[model samples]
Target: MMAVDKGARCLVLNGATLGATGSGVLALFSGGHPLSSAALEGLSATAGMASLCRVLLEQAGWEDGPGRIVAVTGPGSFTGLRATLALAQGLALGYSASLCGVTLGQAYRAREGWSEAYCITRARRDRLFMERPDGTVWAGPSGAIALPARAFVVGNGVSMLDLPQHETLIRADCTSPDPRDIYRAACHADDRPSLQPLYIDAPEARLPSQGLRPSPV
Candidate 1:
């Protein structure tokens, strides 16, 4: 678990997990002191995850105050991502703190010994959300438009697609996204977005009918 050091100055929050196929949550605090390592935990949308995170920081002994707080803006859960955004926005607003973020692919880059990496998340059956190593340029909605094939598709989302591995496609098989990947990206951004989530598919539920139709005689 990340803890407050003798003289830390910045705090980083990991919201990029909102894009993973399953629930992934992480947050860290670092300053000019020693090390900030928080015990990462995964939780479904079941209950209290958000409140729990705040409580964790407090228990770890970090003063939540003015400074930089990083958030991830991306292709992720509509509800979870929105909730994280709401929390980050509220924190920034309340503390008058600055905000920034790292995206899914960029987070992967934080891992070691992986150069020429390609990170992706589910966009739609006909498309995929991706980022270049530069971590700034937007590639394609590709499968639906243009842009070359990819080398490796990170995250369990690829399993959901079961795409072929001919000239393109490779499943990541990684369990959890690396925290260092997030820290690196957060370092690059300091004004995180007010994300409006990117859902790969439309909502499954349907609304009630305006009224029932008459039956034939």
Candidate 2:
């Protein structure tokens, strides 16, 4: 594991697959401060992500690339999450930079200094991804999740669920965790994540009846 220095040049990437847009964010940080950022949106958000990152780095005058790369490991779009991780891993290898991973819930918690709160996000049409107050994450239908009587919910998926009428059911102002929050979490992370995609549910796609082709000898 590589320790992130206060002055290290860091690049943060977030493919917002949990939301409806399928959008993404890229930011450059130096001396523990954000320097520049770019947003990836629309239909080409996944396909053109790498090119955009390159352009962002070039515009920031980081020809040598970043010293560390931080990525959001998600329980969102399977393709989007895979694409983002693939790009992160490839760039890390090419630049010989340290790599770190953080979940949206983790980032939000870290940024807000929330010792306990349920962080939720959309998993699909009816299902939802939730990080429990105890730090355990899971995905399932919204109706299946049982919230505490005086629960505090934070995340974009809050609007999706049908909650009971309770006075203490608090909701946050923001829909999702910001990219800057992710950066802060990465900088102060006590343990380094495996940098793997956090898939709470299986992908929608399935293999063909014939199965996959064999690998070359």
Candidate 3:
């Protein structure tokens, strides 16, 4: 677990598992307690997130910005991950604050207090991102992935996979990891300063068959 100064203001961003309409969570913490939180909706709404965070900080008498920032690095939406990391990086730079990155799977596991669990999330159409208890990660079609018997399943993509009813499976109550859990995970996570998106599958964009024309000299 990372050591943090007492009463330090912290900001947590979790855009990895956005809702269908691009909704995500933003939370503020101080001394390991929540100060405020907001559920941002739609791209247009989230566009003003910086202002919203400023307002929240002001309300809490923290006009200078947070002392630290925690961002959820993802194996989920590519756009969401990129936007979130960019925002976190910008905020950290602007405020001269320390930045930390945590994964959704790590948050879920910590919240569940499970030493062994399967963390899964949607990668794309028919594809899933699975993190085994042993820390191995795999990305592939849901049907192609196999789960252990009596597995403890956690994630938003749980419903997307078709599992056998005969096999015992325990699922978390929520589809997505809680933003608070993300903060908890950040507290225990290594202090690696990386903002890169954890993409499991290759991007869908491809080059056109016709190559670019030569430039005129």
For all candidates in order, the CA lDDT equals 0.53, 0.77, 0.77
> What does candidate 2's lDDT look like per residue over 155-194, in tens digits?
7778776656534677777665677888887877643424
Order of candidate numbers by TM-score, starting with the best? 3, 2, 1
Residues 1-217 of candidate 1 have per-residue lDDT tens digits of 5544423435455443433244555455556332344433333541454575567557555565636556655555455566667777777776667776666666676676444555555443445555556654432444332224665556534444443432465556764465566666666655644544434446557555876667899
Q: Which residue pairs clash within candidate 3? A: none
Q: Which stretches of candidate 3 lie over 4 Å from their true place?
A: 1-7, 19-23, 42-46, 165-167, 207-217
Off by over 4 Å in 2: 1-7, 16-19, 165-167, 190-194, 207-217
Task: Quote the lDDT for 198 in model 1.
Answer: 39
Instruction: Estimate TM-scores for all models.
Output: 0.66, 0.84, 0.85
lDDT order, best first, reads 3, 2, 1
- Predicted structure 1, TM vs. truth: 0.66
lDDT of 3 at 77: 81
- Collision count for each candidate, in order: 9, 0, 0
Collision pairs in model 1:
1-37, 1-38, 1-39, 2-37, 2-38, 99-190, 99-192, 100-192, 110-181
RMSD of 2: 4.8
